[model samples]
Target: AVMDFACPGLMGDLTSFRKIYAAPIGKAGERGASEEEKRIGAARRAELGRLTQGFIHARKADEINASLLPPKTEYVVFIRLTPTQEDMYIRALKQKSLQSMLGRCGKSDAEAPTSVLGVIQNLQKLCNAASLVEASDEFDIDASSKL
Candidate 1:
């Protein structure tokens, strides 16, 4: 399993990680690491080993009890688009050119690649969420199911 926490030398491979990260930090400190630092490092390494072994044991226990595990369930939620949002989506499909879909904000020439890209980007943003494409204060976060 991948560990998401960012604490250096805090995983099962504590000694190796400490030798790479912690030891360097200790050496970089004003007077370098003293006996106290060594003691702390050893204590931390032992603690990590205990925790890692415990996690392994727990996972093994779970595997042994797999026959008693509950069946997994998946959920799907449906949301309807608001009337105004639906109108905007339909109007977006009927636009004749890139310049039109960009509204009055984009000033790129109609035939320019930037204008074409802007239209595509706008469509993508709309499909993902209206709030992502719309800069107006009235844009709602609830406008898209992906949110």
Candidate 2:
């Protein structure tokens, strides 16, 4: 049998996450993947490789992040993508969510995170759509037309 494996931690959690996508192999792969599919797979794998290779300014970045963090807070971004794209994607997601949240709050000023824990919880739900917290959103379920 052809040997190949999927690399985990595509989104986050740093360790042993189940793979969402994987490449194919040999004749079966030839039958399975068109040229574009193969190119996309190669691009994805390359992105993962680039991330696993390590960041040059990681220590500085970590130090800065820690300086802003509260004591004993566990914050980790486990992205399996290129540094630039990953940063952009996260920035976009944060902007989208926080803008809505702040708009909902109706205060133009950015408040000093009164509840870091709550922020984390909300973020967890945002990241992991399968999260129990997400499933438990009564308002969202009630609001959805399909539900």
Candidate 3:
């Protein structure tokens, strides 16, 4: 069985997985792949897929042991952000770097900067506690809205 904490798609035929593995190793990394190289790589990948058909069998958790698992339920809860959290969140959203990243949304060819996830995490931290995102020693614990 294959498992991943963050990316379960690693077990499937995902384009992101292909992109990660197709990147050249050592000095000739991802940046070295030219348009022609990419085309050839795509052709080779297609041939490999054709040759490896039916070689893998994937099973889901439910399929393995349905009796041991319970039915799934999702819950959504809403809470108002504290004034401090709202202020910090708004400031984070207004930052030029974040604004530029957000502006790229909905573009088919736009590549998301790796830092986007970090920026989002920081924003989430800010909502959880001002101390998490702020470096100041004078940060108040009461600034956390979730508490």
Candidate 4:
């Protein structure tokens, strides 16, 4: 029926189109739709399958493999955090637990993120470089776990 106004008889007259396709599909979209409603939806969907069948084919495995790009370079370097940094991370984790228990674990409009996820993110920043959170005047890359 919507097609009558939307595309003017493109799918046929609104009444017939609604009875054949739109109504069945619309009923299927609802939560807890009846078995009969679902069956009708499947039948209607099957009827329209050919219109998109060609576009639904999968890509070949060979094509997928051929499309992959090789990595340019890779290296691994490890650095240990200072004791103070580890202590700060532990304190943040404990604070995050308390905040979660109080139903105050998500970011607020005026605050830096303080949720459990946010606190974990802060810990990650600390691992990368303490300067990210502490705003140190002199950043020491050699001190970061990621460097």
Query: Which candidate number would show the highest TM-score if scored against the true structure?
Result: 3
Candidate 2: the clashing residue pairs are none
Ranking by lDDT: 4, 3, 1, 2
The TM-scores of all predictions, comma-separated, are: 0.30, 0.21, 0.46, 0.40
lDDT of each: 0.62, 0.48, 0.65, 0.68
Instruction: Look at candidate 2 and tell me the lDDT of residue 117.
Output: 40
lDDT at 105, model 3: 65
Better of 1 and 3 by TM-score: 3
Count clashing residue pairs per candidate. 0, 0, 0, 0
Ranking 1 against 4 by lDDT, winner = 4
Model 3 error, position 114 (Å): 1.9
31-61, model 1: which lDDT tens digit per residue? 6567766666667656656756734444576
Candidate closest to the true structure, highest lDDT:
4
Return the lDDT, model 1, position 121: 80
lDDT of 3 by residue, 6-59 (tens): 435444555544554344222233467777766666665665465445554657
lDDT of 2 by residue, 41-114 (tens): 67666665565555323357668878997767578877444343345447645776565655556454455254
lDDT of 3 at 53: 53
Model 1 residue 144 lDDT score:
44
